[model samples]
Target chain A: MDTPIRVHGLTKVYGGGFRAVDALDLNVPRRSFMGFLGPNGAGKTTTIKIVTNMLSATSGRAYINGVSVMEDPKTALADVGAVVETPEFYPYLTPMETLHYLGELRGLSSCETTNRGRDLLDLVKLTDWREKRVGKFSKGMKQRLAIAQALLSQPSVIILDEPTSGLDPRGMVEVRDILKQLHKLDVTVLMSSHLLNEVQEICTDVSLINRGRLLRSGSVADLLDEVKARKIDVRTLRPLTPDMFDRLRAVPGVKGFAVTGDLSFSLDFEGEEDAQARLLIELQNLGLMVVSFKESGLALESLYMSLIMESR
Target chain B: MMEAASVVNNRERLPSDLQQMVTVAKYDVLKHLRSKRLLGLVILEALLLGLTFALPLLLGVDPTDDPAGYMSAFVSWVEILVIIGATMFAGDAIVSEFQSRTGYLLFPNPVKRSTIFVGKYLSTLGIIVLMLVVYYGVAAALVFAMTGGGTLLSLYSMLLACAYGAAAAALGFLISSVFKGSTGSLVLTFFTLFMILPMIAQLLPAGSIKPWFVLTFCGHVISYIMISPYPTDLVDSISLGNGEFMEYWTYYPDIGGSLAVMGGYVLICLALGMYLFRRKEMVS
Candidate 1:
């Protein structure tokens, strides 16, 4: 199958000798939600800009479904919908007007544009504010409108850069839910973001990039399985004394332990799941009244941090 | 995934380049219509037209006899309205796309940069023409009302005013493409066209070749078309105490010459502006 997005030796050097993107190579398979994980100033936005024809790559090339974006942008971008950096619209226009304009530009008929525009607006939850002028919209509303705009053409591939960047918690969840629906609808999504937890939740495949270079790329399951140790959180009915802490650290598979709260702490267990169970049993046998013992949510976070440190 | 595949296969046909250009132009016209800038220009034009009629009455100069002369004088002031309107519409049409990050949404589409540029230029031209129609429509009615006759020279002056407005818009687009900020482009276009060019035309030796090259020189045809027995090369002369005579040459550009200059500006500036816009990267 042809890859939805392919980049080879893509380098973008700005003025004053700043290499924002340096000889980067990446590929996103069809029908996959690929998380483009990176840090600030990591050239994620730059790479997206080049792919969407907003910026030109200094050397090498990028292609959408095997069409060279640099040589023929119109053809390359025909089936691609993108929301790069931030969402901005003509302040005078409403969401419906903006979508209709874009729909026409994308070659949809008037009836189809209206139908699809209304449907997309409903999907983004902007139906009530359809005719309201966008200039008065808050940033979160604009971002949602931008998402609706990106989906107007029913594009095969949707590329979003930090789609949930500036949203409040509820807004973030709302946008994430929309993206989840798109994922289910089989859109090939390549979303670049620094929010690792969001990526871990929404993405099936992952590519980690830093300083304009790709460090790792694989399935999230495979990456998670590669983690050598698991950090398991343990809660006790009462605050543990120093003697109890020493006794807890003496477990056979426990590599280290840190008290995170008065009655809770975490343990680094360098062992398999069965061994972890055995350790948990051992802790319970100590008669310390262990309330709960479960693995923490630091698996992906640790993997990302270690990879970013290794790349640096 | 199958649903998405089917949807992609069943997608509507895309537009051709010409269709896309027209779409962009139409939406841009809508944007201008919904904006206060167009209303502001209309109000300004009305005020200027009011001044044109009232100034003569206030000065006790009766133009009740020579309607052509009154029309010519009235249009001369209205020509400033055309300049202001063109500058406001076209001055930031291209630059604001970059400065305000509107290009983030616009440039990613299937349309070409040249199409966007041409679409914006055509929309700006249309608005300017609309403004001119209103201004001249009022002037023609007043002339007919006052003298019971309106000369063809008014029509001829209207054409020249349009050419001058097109040139000014072209110049504005050129300045807009060069600058990254809308305010800077707007201010510079106004100052260069209204203040600097006219000042240069005034400061240059009356008969120098430099004045002919300036856009404001071509703008004179709007007012010069009103003069009867149309003024010759040198309209007046003045003598200094040192026995040196300073001749003030009438920098009247004939119809063909004026069209050439204005058309040249339109073609060259538009081509250059489009080229720059196409090559410009959306780094911001």
Candidate 2:
């Protein structure tokens, strides 16, 4: 039995001929952290909603843990935990109470729910706000609580739709830390996000989708290897003037460049190590003292955009 | 570590349908209470009780005499309480899940949609019942204290009130299932119960047709049951020019018939409401 999250010819044509998800077939292997990556309106959320059984497909099928969602959602989703589209709570329930409510629905006893709730809350770092009403908490706090609830049932498969979306930088880090902890567990995670860096930090594999269709999918390393292009960040001791920007863009092997800070700019280059070394010498010839030069680590971002353009 | 394994094992086991309903009901009760909708209705009930006892004193009318008539005055107020309860608790039972996106949190669970509908319906009905019981309990005690006469008829009225509440709340749930926003559901449910149905009942009885199909029409049984001999329909006619007559009519609902009408609403409206709730998607 293939217990991975699988969607075959899954299509969702909303009212008025809007195809939110069009025959999107994806597979997240067992115990693999697969990033369902795409731009906004790329059918990522629509596919996730279908997989979670929150919305019916126009046609085709979705399965979670080897059970067909459209046929028997209750059983297909029994071992699945999903947070879809910026989930909101009852607002009146406290974090602890929310966990208990969800835990009981999953068939845990009072003692077990309590213990699991406490452990989950502690894991999400929401213990201090355990008794606080969710309505009074900020969006970040609610997002963190969402993580706690998703993991409360100890589900074998966890689905998160933009878990770090709409959070401040600090909140994103907090949620990322929790996600990192999940990566250590024996659970399968199928998280959807528009940002490549967000999933690249933790996901084992990624699927690039666009306009309701899957464009490409593979291991994180394989996808990165497919596109050797990178955006390198270079910080200088002295700020470059307007003319200096023109000269910097003209450097050999430097395909493009943008001003990042007063003393720094990012160079979009595609080349081997010899061309990259020549780039440093070119910058030195311009009388600029290089403070730092390194890759920003968003290789798949370039590939994602190029595929979206080609798919169109 | 051993305890952790046991906990994990416990979670893997799915609960029975009945257990899921109970769990959903339990949490729904907490939602209503924590939202203060239940408490607000109770406070309003207390105020109504206060007004019921106070209005008579201020008007210098003694409830001690004709205790049956005095207690019967509560019938109209109880009807209003039931409407308010239905509007507040049941009006948003299903719509809020979609409008607020809380469905994202709930719909993914292993529980069935029918189970969620019944559980929420029970919780809403339970609150209305509690409100009715408190109102009737006080009225009954006052009537018992004022006279040693039997308050048997008031019990019937209270039972009818609960039935009416159930029907009205089911109607509210139906409206909630149909509408997409809280305000729209609340306004439609309140007006449908408080004004629209009663007006229809009034107009229909003029044509010698009982609006027995209307739940609010049957709700009048709460007060009419208090009147002895069970009042029947009344008619008054005014002679126009040339001996033409214009007839005006007043209708009283029958206990058995009206109870059946309300029961039909409880079944049909809930069936329809559950159907819509199950079919509703969490899009947008």
Candidate 3:
């Protein structure tokens, strides 16, 4: 029940009066995986920046573990570690040396620093390249090193701004596993990504914002149930007549239906299991060649599109 | 209860913030040492000393013929070489970090910006001083072996050279922090040091602005040791007088005044650079 981070009515305006984020509020519980999902230019990154105290919030408040980022950033940031965009490091330095420098900044004892550095390098699967200069690292290698460094202080809340944007498929899998592993350690993770599937596969909760406004925020299950109450897709062997389609649409609890494809029809209802039995009976009575029917999980792409479309 | 107690004990060992800043500083100094840039600069000082002796021999200039005039010209050439090397080194120190995007990782830590600034600055100055010591050794050996006209005045002049070298390095650090790119910072530093500042000094009425050239401060400080009429026949081969002031200010030389001016210029510029860097948003 403890809130690790809270952003209240946050808004940001750029020069010449362009609003990037407006009237946004978010609450991330401690030790939860919170995904921030939106289309490009939807204020997802802006929100992360404001919460991390990188970009100034025009009118709002942000607190990290009850410490206001505005009132005391030095103390507030003490528990927060962030990797904004491409993580930069001294090219001439090896990954181990880079960690040693950052460890010092995080107050690690020399012995503890070396031990932690080696452990993290091994965790990121970079122990083999520990002494190699970072300049020679590929983009994926550099990103993995960045993640290890972010975890160096054992921060309570870790924020990653599109941490896996440009990675290859293998790299994305590596990053996803890394995030999942961190989640096991009781660390609160706030990640922003335009990749919907990445968010869908990993996040326990999500907050969607668009056009400088908060569209929706909740656990993936809650948001899915709220927006997808009556949507069901049924596949049949042949196209149905208009009268048969109308009858199905006029069912007591059915909200809507659409022939989305040649053999598949989308059925939307007013409530969960509202008329699910009645729906099956009607299709059976009509002697319709029903082949297969399925309910979609809370896929972020659908939720994201619905949220953005409703806002417009 | 035992598990809970162990967990509580684990949290107590976390490092405090000041300890972290020192660690970051130590890492930066170590990286510089490994790269051997400091050693290379010190070797430059040795090379300058060698040039002083070798050039005279190569051109066949008799040391006994006008020893004072030959010594003055040699001092100026060495001064120019020292200034060039120190400026280039200082200018690249901080700006290179920005260029490489390394500041993004370091600045976001729990440490204060001033800690990073002072740590890097002092480490760089240490390297310059190392070079100065080497230069001094070579200069002393050359003075005794080649001229046999060695005096304590020559030794003191070398120390003054080191002081001026430190000043130049500090000034370059300030400029490096202001400019964005390494190449741009270097070009601007050299231009300001050589072309612009002296030109401005020339534009002012002769005595009204000589102290403005940091090189002028060096010229004055060096002239005091080499030009002052001290009896060289003394057993200790040491004497002190107010001759550097005369060479620098000519008619209106003030040694304390020159030191104060140079000190003021260095302090103000460094303060301004730090303020600018602290507020700057690193886009890279």
Highest-DockQ candidate: 1
Which parts of model 2 are misplaced by more than 4 Å? A1-3, A238-289, B1-12, B234-237, B246-249
TM-score of chain A for the candidates in order shown: 0.95, 0.90, 0.80
User: In model 3, which runs have C-alpha deviations exceeding 4 angstroms?
Assistant: A9-11, A50-53, A56-60, A229-298, B1-21, B34-47, B64-82, B92-98, B147-159, B162-166, B206-224, B229-254
lDDT of each: 0.86, 0.85, 0.70
In lDDT terms, how accurate is model 2?
0.85
DockQ preference between candidates 1 and 3, better one: 1
Error in Å for residue B80 of model 2: 1.5
Clashing pairs in 3: A104-B20, A230-A269, B224-B244
Off by over 4 Å in 1: B1-5, B9-12, B55-61, B235-237, B246-248
**Number of backbone clashes in candidate 2:** 0
By DockQ: ranked, best first: 1, 2, 3
Q: Write the per-residue lDDT of candidate 2 for residues B1-284, one digit (tens) a residue.
A: 21242214422588977888988888888787766777787788778777877887899976667767878877768888889999999998899999988898999898889999999999998878878888888877766666656477888889999999999999999999999899999999999999999888878866878677778888988988888989997888878889899887777788899888888898998999999988888888
- Return the interface RMSD of model 1: 2.8
lDDT of 2 at A103: 81
Per-candidate interface DockQ score: 0.61, 0.49, 0.25
